[model samples]
Target: MPESLEKHGVSVLVLDADGTPIATVQDALDLLVSASYEGAELVAVPAGRFDDSFYDLSSGLAGEVLQKLANYRLRLAVFGDISRHLRASKALPDLVRELNRGRDVWFVTDLDELDARLSG
Candidate 1:
């Protein structure tokens, strides 16, 4: 996806929903680099961009991807409905809750929700 910049209360790099899926840690790193190159404070990725393994906590893809972003001090906003994944995993809901409480990562239902969070 062509990285697009959106300036709300914060500078955000928004990825298109129809773009290529992020299937590996390398993909996440590439995205992180893109955000950094664009001098964005946050990167908003469509939830659908992530592979299914990302939502399956047992696969450890989420942890790896998140840790990489954290290591670089890059904030990420995953926007889209991930309710199906949340419902399937007993641990995911709590994990999302905790992440939402922090500044590093946020799981939002839409850009509007992400906008609200950034505005706050």
Candidate 2:
């Protein structure tokens, strides 16, 4: 599926197509390219876009994907409540907390929150 573009406040962002799971590094690369093609500075992705292994830090999928996005200087706004994953793993919550504190990555509860962050 192709990426979808949306306006969040004044900022335009690319969103992952529904049902597309970013399961590997290649997926991250594709997402970056799509975002670039859409002329978006950020990408709003649902937590469900990630594969199960992404929550399993040991699999390194999450870190690898984040690295790719960082290298491309793209911002990622993960929009969803990942409370279940936080409960399932001790490390993920801390990692998410740190990421949310940074400029490049943000774990947001919803699109409106992401839009607020983009605007404010």
Give the best candidate by TM-score.
1
Model 2 Cα lDDT, one tens digit per residue, 43-120: 888888888898899999988998888888888888887889889998999998998787788999998887777666
- What is the lDDT of every predicted structure here? 0.89, 0.81
Could you estimate the TM-score for every candidate?
0.93, 0.87
lDDT of 1: 0.89
Q: How much is 19 displaced in model 1, in angstroms?
A: 1.4
Residues 3-117, candidate 1, lDDT per residue (tens digit)? 6656565778999988878999999999888888888888999999999999999999999999999899889999998999999999999999999999889999898898888
TM-score of 1: 0.93
Candidate 2: give the clashing pairs.
none
Error of 2 at 44 (Å): 0.4
List of clashing residue pairs for candidate 1: none
